[model samples]
Target: MDDNNSFQTLTDYSLQVFQLCRLLWGPIETPKNVQLINQAYFEDQQRRHLLSNWLHQCILSQPQQEQWIMQNCEFLSRGLLNDCVKFAHDEGDLRLAALVHAASGSNTVRDILRHCAHEDIVDVYSKDFRRTIAILSGEFIVKGHNLVDQNRTTYWQMALALHLWFANSASDSVSTIVRDFESAYQEHYWLEPIAHHGNTKALDLRWKLLKLYTDDTYPIDNVFDVNSYTQNPFDYRL
Candidate 1:
């Protein structure tokens, strides 16, 4: 279909879904109520899967219009967005999940990291790292707009994701990933709370060691072993 027709169809259907959501889940009028609503919605796997499929279709139709969908579409509640994020992850589309996380302000990206077992997280990164870095970037294009500066939370989480993967997995490109992360961190270091409660000194020391080790001039073994590191590398302050 043409762009205009596609946009109209999506908007209309989304509105219908929005109404249905309200009727099915009740009013999400306040923060407390929204939380309760999301909890209830989470339990409805059938509905969540349906919503996520529709969301995925919309995203495919307008790949760059995520912010437009999130800002203008009435159907996408935080609950639905979180469901989409989860769906993307389950489908092994981490890039789509990250984009939705950035666009919809969903906590599922961080939530997944926080809730999953360490082995599961390691498995995901090890398998996906060879294929993608869309989740690790600080900047993203949403609805044709360049969002050069993401929120502090998103930036920190992206860094944390990379750090965890790098710590646990062995790869030839890991040093490059470390360098990119350090650059992004330096660029956004002035932003509050990105490094708050994080062990900055340890991070700095590791960066240097990784650089040296990956350079092949020096051998640094077990420096980033996940088992030796703290359970929460960035700390629970987040």
Candidate 2:
């Protein structure tokens, strides 16, 4: 364990980031008055909040820093930004959420995408992503596309990426997102869920909530489907 960054250190670093995010957005402890803070607007206003710079400046040693960077790359690329989008919608701050949403396409995701050789396919994903899914049972190009789980084809990821890319550019204001979110939502509403089944429900919930700012509106009372803001954030849970 001497060579590795202890879990505590990682936890501390994560807490630091969380505090910074909360300070920019709102205090998590007293959310009743957190209001609809725009983290994106305030974040940009901060002198320099570059994750790259933060990675280097932190107290973590080089290996630890490298590890953190790798982990964070995936977090921002797949999770954090998406959570921000969901929170923005839940808090009625679409404009700010839109900013983070815009940032999601940050180069890392694009870089990961380069590894895929097929442009026509992204990964295999079940279409429309229902929580209770049927085994591809029969859609195999003609029928069970016959697998319990499938990654979306490159074409699927490409189309999705493009749609989101355009959505980012078109984001104007909270009011605009009322319609704009739907444009993005149309792609999300029924798109296939990720291939892994381990946390299928949570993953599905996440996607639903991510586009939640879009038209994927869940009933405000249906806490099961979305907006569990009062709960611990993903970082803290880890």
CA lDDT of each prediction against the hidden true structure: 0.38, 0.33
Using all chains and alpha carbons, the TM-scores for the candidates as numbered come to 0.25, 0.25
What 10-residue stretch in candidate 2 is worst by lDDT? 129-138
Cα TM-score of candidate 1: 0.25
RMSD of each: 20.9, 16.2
Candidate 2 residue-wise lDDT, 5-55, digit = tens: 455555654454454344333422323556647765444333123322332
- Candidate 1, run of 10 with poorest lDDT: 70-79
lDDT for 150 in candidate 1 is: 36
Candidate 1 ranges with C-alpha deviation above 4 Å: 1-149, 154-157, 160-172, 189-208, 215-238
Model 2, total clashes:
24
The model with the greatest lDDT is: 1
